[model samples]
Target: MNQYIDIVLRSVTIYFFILIALRIFGKKELSQLNTADVILILLISNSVQNAMVGANTSLISGIIAAFALFCINYIFKKVMLKSSFIKKLVQDKPEILIHNGITYYKTLARLGITSDELEEAIREHGLEHYNEVKLAMFEIDGNISIISGNEYLKQTHFKKKIIHKNLAGKK
Candidate 1:
């Protein structure tokens, strides 16, 4: 096989391997990257680079590997759009966490969500308790979306905020 073809084949193989690994691990890993998550991502990229290009570390080999990855990704997305089973395999279905103030404890446990995490998501949406929630869903993107029953409170999308407190007292 040509060296360029070899590079392309290796890159595509690694791409599918990572995709399958992500599917088995769950979609929650896709959201909310912490310091550790960032580190893991950097390490994963570095680890896979050699595997994709093998001993050929030339510029052309690198470009070929990248092109192969992008083409495979585009093809995968198109196939998923036309095939429900492929789409379901790659993405998790949204789950209902709460409805009419009734919390789904079983669903929470199955999704590995703790009570504290649920309460934090509720409080982030300005709700005092689970009883105030009309509906709460564990979205496919790994976010807990809350809909409150209060008429006065305007409906709004919840976005997670990361606060970096300044150590210096000076404002």
Candidate 2:
């Protein structure tokens, strides 16, 4: 019974410690999950699990893992700030899946994104044809960025026109 109580208290305490550690990790830590962040999270969770379970995992191990994670993040951020090459290596370059209505098959294959997936992505943006798309960028985070070729040519909305007219009148 006492052992069960100890386990419960330990779990609760570790849970709060994780929350605090995550907060210290920084805003970008959760909002903008990069490759390194994802890897760290995977490792941290595994380490914490071991910490939660006794025998193989110890309380000290959990605290050490948390501390190590925090240190690594701090060091990496410092390195990234000073080095552009390190930044590029850790933060992957965006891929160009489609350019000027023509699809980059090799790029898509390399990204493992199928034609159907590409079509679905573009279609979700309310785009009907590839010709309407001027530049379709594949972000490092696996997000599709679609820009219409006619964006500049497209007529301004009435709301924008009215605002412009009102500003002109004031001027």
Candidate 3:
């Protein structure tokens, strides 16, 4: 096979594999970037670099591989926008975490979100208690969006706090 064609095929394969892997691992990984998450992303890119370019280390080969990746990514996004089924397959739907101040335990468990995390999200929205939340959703982007029941106390922006140490004094 032509080296350029080989590069294109390899790039496309790697792209699809990473996409499926991210989807299977859950969307939460995409939303929050802790130290480990950042390291993992860097390592993944390094590891896949050789797989995409193979034994060809020439500057042209590398450029071709990169161009192929960008092309496919653009095409994929366009297809996703035009096709609802493709969009649904590629993106996660928003999940209701709380409704009318009632926490959906099942949904929380399924999403691997603990109560403490939910409480923190609630507090970040300026709500003192879960009952003060009118609606809370785990958005497709991995953010927990909260709607307060008290119209007067509604908050439009939430600031997420970075905790260096836990309650047990462990990092």
Candidate 4:
């Protein structure tokens, strides 16, 4: 096989692998990452570099690999937009955490959210309590979106929740 072709194939494979890994691992918080998350990303990229480009440490090889990633990412996004099944398979649906000021304890527990975090998000939206919220949704992109029932704060508030791992008693 030609070296450039080999590089493209390898890079594409790595891209899909990483995508599936992230989906399976439930890494929803792309906007807010902790220190360990950042370190893991750096390490994963460094580790995958050799897998994608192999021993060809040349400038052209690196560019080819990058180009392959960009092309695949573009095509993937297009397909996802057009195919609901693919979109659902690749991403999680938005979770409703509260409705009519009623908190869904089960939903919060399932999404690894704590009451304190939810309260903080509510406060950010100028609400004193969850009862003040008309609707609270854990958005697909890892944002806590709050719609307050308060007549003064009718606008929706979107806040990124810091991803927490192994919060005591949450398995």
Candidate 5:
């Protein structure tokens, strides 16, 4: 009976430590997740095994940890809502990766993104060359949003406008 109790205590402590450490590490936004972030998660999980459980986490403790995590996350979001500083800290702000068809090399360097990576990201939007893009930004969620050249917009907008105009006439 005493051994079982000691085991339960150890399991709960490990669960608490892993949960709190992850929350406090402050990689709140997906955009902040880089190679380093992934590696950190892998290492954390590896190190926390003995602390969390022996074979698998027991049902009751898992439920308790889930509830604790959810409550802590709820509190964090509420706090962020009330505090602009916290919001900025948690959410990655949109930053321009390109302006006027020119890549912002310095900004890319600061963000640890290379021009090659930018080109690759833009490729998803069918951009064949850098000059084809008018503006590009790395979104808060780590998505690459690219605005194509003016001619591209003009052609695309014309089609959309024509479709809308035709729909209006039908109405």
Candidate 6:
């Protein structure tokens, strides 16, 4: 019984710890998982597995810990949905990268996004140049969405691979 309580406590602590860590790391980290990010996630899971299970290696103990994690996650999500304050704390607001063909350099620099990356996102959206983009946003999900002022150049919301050479030539 005592060991089970310890497992639950450890699991809960680790869960909150990770949640806070992710929040502190910013939303960009969640947008795309690079090679290092994948390895880090794997290593974190492996390291915390033992901490959650402890010495009890029993199936029941493992199940209990897993159940606790799921329950906590579900409850957290529900609370976040209902409470704007909690939601704001747990998630990032969308960032405007460009508006009316003017780039927000300060916002981009603060978000650690380079001009090159922004240009790449613009190109990926099939826009020939930044001037063609009326609005560009770094969404909370880590995707850059572009809205073109040119009606003819507008495209559906999707992540398309940027082709270096089109009929018009390289952008």
Q: In candidate 5, where is summed lDDT lowest over 10 consecutive residues? A: 153-162
Clashes of 1: 0
Task: For model 1, give the 10-residue run with minimal summed lDDT.
Answer: 162-171
What is the per-residue lDDT of model 6 for residues 1-171, given as tens digits with 9 covering 90 to 100? 698889888899999999999988877777767899999999999999999989888999899899889988999999998999999988889999999889999999998898988988888778878888899999888888999998887565556576655544734
Distance from true position, residue 1, model 5, in Å?
20
Candidate 3 runs further than 4 Å off:
160-171
Candidate 1: residue 13 Cα off by (Å)? 1.0
**Candidate 6's C-alpha lDDT?**
0.87
Worst 10 residues of 4 by lDDT: 154-163
- Model 1 regions lying over 4 Å from their true place: 155-171
Tens-digit lDDT string for candidate 1 (40-128)? 88999899999999999999999999999999999999999999999987899999999999999999999888899899889888898
Best by lDDT: 3
For candidate 3, the per-residue lDDT at 145 reads 93
Give the whole-model CA lDDT for all candidates, comma-separated: 0.90, 0.66, 0.93, 0.88, 0.66, 0.87
Clashes of each: 0, 0, 0, 0, 0, 0
Tens-digit lDDT track for model 2 on 41-123? 89987776755545535666556545555655677679979999987656657788788899999988876677887886677
Error of 4 at 25 (Å): 1.8
Top candidate when judged by TM-score against the true structure: 3
Query: How does each model score on TM-score?
Result: 0.87, 0.55, 0.88, 0.86, 0.61, 0.85
Give the winner by lDDT: 1 or 3.
3
The regions of model 2 sitting more than 4 angstroms off are 1-56, 152-171
Q: How well does model 5 score by local distance difference test?
A: 0.66
Cα displacement (Å) at residue 168, model 1: 15
* Tens-digit lDDT track of model 5 for 87-140: 875566888988878888888877767677787777767677888888898876
TM-score preference between candidates 1 and 3, better one = 3
The residue pairs in collision within model 2 are none
